[model samples]
Target: MSSDDDPPESDPSPHVTAVVLAAGRGERLRSELPKPLYSVCGRAMASYVLHALANAGVSRAVVVVPPDGRGRLIEQRLREDAPDLNLCFAVQQEPRGTADAVLAAKGQVHTTQVLVVNGDLPLLSAEQIRPVLCHDHNDAVIATAQVDDPAEMGRIVRDSQGRLVATVEYRDADPAERAIREVNLGLYVFRSDFLWNALEQIVAQTRTGEAYATDAIPCAVRNQSAIAVEVELPDGRLNVETPADAANAEAVIRHRIIDRLLDSGAHIRDRNAVWIDAQASVDEGAVIEPGSHIRGNATIAQGSSIGPNAIIEASTVGRNCNLESCTVRGSVLHDNVEVGPYSTIRPGCTIDSHAHIGTHAELKEAHIGEHVQIGHFSYIGDAEIGARTNIGAGAITCNFDGQSKQRTIIGEDAFIGSDTMLIAPVRIGNRARTGAGAVVNKNVPDGGNAVGHPARLTPSRRAHSTTGDEL
Candidate 1:
């Protein structure tokens, strides 16, 4: 039962439902966004937990979202990104207690066993979750850790028979309990029926009218139900609820990603060249030069060369593409495409097969067709360039006019001369040619030649258009 698959019922298997508690208003974090939505290693922190759960074969999940606008955003993102994973959202109307949040999702979970997890733990992996689930207990099994200091944490209390008796909070615990080294890490596996019953009893009997999941442990123990403790791997637990903690989490996640990549045979030229949430495939002969950061699920194919200093993110580079000293984000480059010595290929830019972006060129939200050449010191934004076009040095598409951005289209075999400035919302047709130092602000017909500022066609040039040399 992987997180992406349906749970099964058998020995060494259990129909498990995950209840992720994400409703807390992290005052300590001091950010307007919900804590779970905060980024770690270029992805939302909660995504790590979701990935772990999915990998562990726990398919069904109930994310307890806060009763706020952020919760809706979380649901929307989850629907878009992880729709295949059985996801249901329950609202925590207020910051009451962790126990109450789980109770809110009672009706949605059908499995006999439930795994409660913290949404803010970014370092936890699926392997750590299996132990708690496999522990045979009729009542509950909690993941506890042996920390050097148990201050302000719930201390796990055990009986003479080594059964979990109760968890004593730091504020309420006696001196002996406070001295205990083992502390609850707020992860648990519980029988669904027992959990539901315990929640109901706590809500009814407690004077504060707020139920806590921790309070249910004593209730089960008082009834003489079997309760067990499972200690977690020392390095598996991480709490990232504050800015400091978030930084720490980032460092840990970065190191782990680097280790995973190195173990998988990827070379890291420089530790400072960050590869965040990137999936890269380098052929044995490919070289990733220094000062290049590849991030956001990008992939580099075989024989490709990237960076002396470049950045590629959320993009795909085809085989044998040469990307040196350039910055490419949210873009795609096809095979044999060459870019940079100093270039910016911004989001939504696509350079087709065999296209060349020469030195000091910048492109934003543009589409370059195959075999196109964009010369040095050119700015091509909000534009479309057809196949086999040649754009000269200093040619620019003036996309912005202080109010709105407009489009420019250059057709196949079009030649844009040096020092040419193409004002927005213009089109240059196939086989069209613009003379040197031309400022074109209007549409030019196919096979036509235009010259001068706010260019107009030269009549003599039109008659002998075919006689001119290819650009």
Candidate 2:
């Protein structure tokens, strides 16, 4: 009843629990935030690994964190990002090593198999992780990749006829072992019993006094324990530790997201100039112009055209909408809305359908009704405009008078004149009219007319009939 590409109905390996190594203090990044909490494509870097584990059908996880302030922050962010996965935390008391980090999580992992992974890898995916989960017959399975340059990676050493020899770190390997091309990818799956026994036997390396996970492989070989080495291509194994690595990870993630958008019928003219976050959703038939950034769960509905230099964050843009050279944050624009160049829509603003916002207009905390027209160079804040209202050029809503912010309410079918200033706590009734340069400080009744500075209410003006008489 379903295609082969569809995800399975249940978890493939529910007996496998993941142990994520994240307690390391990354000093090379020179950031106050923890390395695992660093942002990659507008998401925490470690979230990718957790998502990969979920994709591989491993839902239960125990994240190992340092026993400090960094651990609390990492735990909180991971909980927010990957809430679907059943997760718990384990504290690594000291900066011992990867092996020690895994051992710290031993108490939390109750599954038959344990999946160990590094949290700094932002480019990891489900396809790369699923293969290691398949080889469950062996006591331990280590994922290996062949790279063009194995500069400082741990090498997978083998004896004559290519039998398993040992996993040697670059700092501790001989010349022959260093020349081997196959390197450890730092993704491993081990049986729970074998892992606990092997990790306990590993001694700290003399050079760094740290017990590396790579040392467990040699112990398995020496003890004649069944071990499997799964070979995969070098694609999504970038471990981000520095600024350069972070940039590379972001570029790879952006490319993948752009490719997905293109495949889903979205039009991106200049891919090189746009930066979209991983959480953004661009529907089919949407056109994204150059220099645009759609970030933080923003949604662009179908038939919408987003600009040649627009920054939309945490907003929703409806169908057939056009936004050009604007910055919209935390706002909602309904269908058939048109926002002109250099307009800024700040938080808590909602523009209804058929509304036309002219160039250089700024709105904040304002609720605009249907068919509303706001002309150029206007600033409307803390205001609510009714349907079919026409706000003229350079109109201002002086809602803040130094002490507190007040509200401006304009009724339906109102015509606000050019350069008009409506002072705080003012109300303009339905069908009311204001002359150019009027500064109104009081309320106007329905169908009334206000003119001149410190505007006073006057008699309603009637429309002229075809016979030259007032209607």
Tens-place lDDT per residue, model 2, 1-471, is 100012323588898999999898789988888888898887887777887788778889999999878899999998877735788999999888888899899889889999999989888877778888887766777877778777787788767766667777889889988998888777888888888888887743336667866567766677666454655654544677779878888898888888888878999999999988877889989999999999877899999999999999989999999999999999999999999999999999999999999999999999999999999999999999999999999999999989999999999999999999999788887888888889988777667688878886654443311222111
RMSD of each: 4.3, 5.2
lDDT of 1 at 292: 73
TM-score leader: 2
Residue 186's C-alpha lDDT in candidate 2? 79
lDDT per residue (tens digit) for residues 1-471 in model 1? 011212222234338899988887778899887887777766666767776777676788899998868889877755554523588899988777878899888989998898888888777776667678776456777878788866577788888877788888889999989999888877788888999998888877778866688888887788787455565656634667679878877777776666555555555676566544513334444556777766756777767888878887878888899999998889989999999798889999989999999999999999999999999999999999999999999999999989999999999999999989988878888999898899888777788899987787897655643423211
Which portions of model 1 miss their true places by more than 4 Å?
1-14, 149-152, 173-179, 226-228, 232-236, 278-290, 401-403, 463-471
How high is each candidate's TM-score?
Answer: 0.88, 0.89
Candidate 1 TM-score to native: 0.88
Query: Residue 63 deviation, candidate 2, in Å?
Result: 2.1
Query: Which residue pairs clash in candidate 1?
Result: 1-57, 2-57, 2-58, 3-54, 3-57, 3-58, 99-213
